[model samples]
Target: MMFDKVIAAVDKKLERFDPIWQAENGVGGQRDRYYDKTGVAKWREWRGVKDTMVDYGAWLKNLASMAMMVASAPIPCLKGFWEYRWMGSYLGTFMFIDRLFEGFRGYELVTAHKCMHAIVRSLTKKIAFCLSNDRRLGGGKDTDRIVPMDEVLPPLFMMGFKELVPFPLQTLPEFIICDVDQHIEPYYIDVAESFGLPADVCSRCAAETGVALDDAFPLIGKAMISTNMPCNASEATSMFQRRRIGMPDFPVTLAMIHNEPGAHPYSTQMLKDAIAFVEKEYGVKYDWDNLFKYAKLMNEQNTIELEKWDYFKTPYSALCGIAETLYRLYAWASVNGTDPYFNKVDRQVIKIMRKAYEEKKEPFGGRTRHRAFLWGPSAVYYTDFPTWIQNCWGINIVLNMDSTMGHNMINTEDPDEAIKDLALFSEKATMRHHAVGGWDNVNAIWEWAKNFNCDMVLMNDNIACKGMLGVHALMEEQARDLGFHFIFIEHDLEDCRTVSRQDMRNCVNGYMSVVLGEEPLDPTLVEFDDSDAY
Candidate 1:
């Protein structure tokens, strides 16, 4: 009876496990090696080879007989044994399929499977705990313990894990959290650390099991805080500094005002126009004195009275003013050969807003949301405006519509599309323009870098995406040849928590160094000293 129940469950799962669903869920596709015929053949070949090395046929036969006996046993006497045995069988079959698929594709299947296993184990453990405690699980308390929908599912999926997991498992939060906290996080951390980060950096990695376990075992929030603290400060400071110096100066700083609330475009063409104007007005040569004068005048003209416009309406105009002011400062720096401090200006902006938001200060106005502007000599030469004035001020920059490599490509099914997309994005999105794609091959990437004169290349290594590893390696090699710096960051774009603030900072710092031709300030210098706190 026990064996019959287990088989029945497996049969049901198999019948319900749609190939279309698997394809939609990221377990099938061109990138998934297991789905391909060649990969399947290879796995079968491997299985045959492995079978010759051991008496696996006999072992399986004996196990099958025992399973049958257990399944047919009296229901009351075999309930516990059947449940345990059947669950193992279910998982073992699932893993076998996963491994076979991975072996055929020439990709490591361990990461995804480990994640699945973790989730399964976690759920089982939690159910066992709840059963032991004689407590009903539901409502807000259950919601609090539930793994975030994003955390349990792969990013490639359109839906959340809550929508994908077996209905029986959805009630078990501890199980999902445990699997991720135990299995998946460690794998990611291990891969990240293998890149030769310093011991201190490794220790600070939030995904480290030792750190996670410390939080899990004790039910302590403080352990969680300590694990994440190091990277946060490092990252924030790095991004702040990168924007300060790496941004170049241009003539006509134009920005698009997002009509929608809280929807700021990370890149805009209006700013590009301002940059172009600065370039033509000042000439190819850096003319500090005149540039500053022009910027000051522009700022004065753009400034508006607080009473005239809504707060949102004011941000665009204020952004224009800030851009003008920054240009003036950049001009001053050119002649003096000294760094212009942006921290003071930034602090002032913060101060003005703090009063408006917190203090309920009178006349809540004069606030702006302009973070930074892009500028460089490249903007000037790239323009093709007929009129000298129009050419100088033309901000015909195109925004990158698709940032992902797979999404950006015209022929995503073909591996060579990676090379094509990279070249197209770079060429189309030069200077004021922006495009996104990753490298397909080393030679293709090298060619693009040389042609476009890229100063830096950033790569994200997702351990789950086995198809991208070779391309990543090629990108690193191409970076060396093209005389550009390469910076690799580990991140799950879908799961923001996977990337700490410090990781972002380090990446930004590396990019700044490449763009500015200078070393960034050390994270340690900016770190607040808390040792003396009571």
Candidate 2:
């Protein structure tokens, strides 16, 4: 399921990165960006050619892009109007706009990566198309050139290389797990077992491995770039995939910054060579200047996100629990810095808080019955359970490990600093965060959870991940020391076949109703035998 093109009909009408489309929409401008006719597209500012160059023509063309989006939006919006089933898809359209202006947050972060890329590309195309309508500069003599989609590579098909290839995941359809989760996870997971990947291996890794070993997933790129970030499984899968695809794979072994103090510096310098390797692979030169510019934007994004996080610390936030977690993933986890949407969202958050404070209103009716925090990944068993907790039980989840662990800090002054910062921060993100030492992650999760006034600590346990299972006692002890109510749930955040949605709902319902002495059962959850597919 190449969801990136699920809405291709609408996408074709609003071509991204093509100038001709914008001109047709009446916003015409210049074509050629004469400053650097190189493979990497960038503004004059990126070349250290002074950031003062006024591109009024580009502005004029963007007006046309805006106009085109408004005029063409009804086509997509109509999908939402038909029925409630299309509602998530319809709301997804709005989420695209939301992400367009505010970057990742809400539905934008929690949905499939292909869906995320599609949404972002849809905007980029509109803007690119609008900019392509240059009828102004030098009598519309030049046009901004973009690597045509047909010619574009599948971005770094793995996580670690994104620092060099900006918006790496944005270019491909991640069908292995996300867009086609139900069909792929269930089918490929079994395939993984059949292919001799020990059942004890992390299911997430096994899923990716099985797909690559059998060549089940789509071939977005001939080559793959991956890392041994926190486990050997990634290396094993990436190696097998490289062999299967008949292309060389570039894999980096991540360093624990805490133990290896020079890890960030060494990794940053190495990534420069890594970028060159990528350039050779894709036959495209690395945009070093543009990299710094993107870092600046990412730095700006991180700054605003920290400010946005402060809102949740208030007695109650309009940014409730799961919604907060969703936005957290959106702002910090994905392709955030490439656009101005994040800054716009950051500013909008200030307005939201200001209005809330002025009206003396709480995000909840009064106050949250319990201030909660998730130590592992957010729950996928029930997509709406977090919202259910907030409205029905008055419990608000303000923090989580997946989105917040490596996001506490980042640097953006220049290429080197930003690279080092990313290396350091990423070392502390994801599964790597907990691998620093024995029970170190347990304490860290508590520290951050407590920092945000989280009194109730919850975890949606992945039964298949034996590593976390080994640390359960330590995590419980830490929670007990902090005087926090800790609840560990058995379910996979990405795979629901292990535990059904109703099964989890009953578990959570028991905790909130019976354990916490809250209100009566929500009665909202239903017995969905096949909830995973939903």
Winning candidate number (lDDT): 2
lDDT per residue (tens digit) for residues 1-534 in model 1: 986687556645653233222333445321222333211212221222222222233234334544543444334213322332122222233223232222111011111122223233333443333322221211222222221111111111111112211111112222122211212234334433454433233221323322222222112000000101112322322232223223232211111122222322221232223223333432332233433433332222223211111221222222121122222222121111111222223234333444443444322022111111112111111111011111111111111111111112222233233223222321222111211112222234334333323343434443333334456665676667656655555543212244432343345444554655543122221112211111
Across residues 1-534, which tens digit of lDDT does each residue of candidate 2 receive?
465455454446545333223323445211221122211113221111111112222233444544555455443323223321212222233222221111112221222222233334444443233223222211111221221111011121112233332333211222212322333354556777897777766666666666555554323333445556555554565566556656445565556444367666665565555556666666665554555555666666666667657866766355555545545554454444555665555556556655665566665445357787776553441244564455345566676665564543444345556566666665654556653323555567777777888888777677766556677787778777879988887766445566655677666777776877766322222222334233
lDDT of model 2 at position 506: 69
**TM-score of model number 1:** 0.21
* Candidate 1, position 51, lDDT: 24
Cα deviation at 498, candidate 2, in Å, is 1.9
lDDT against the true structure, each candidate? 0.26, 0.47
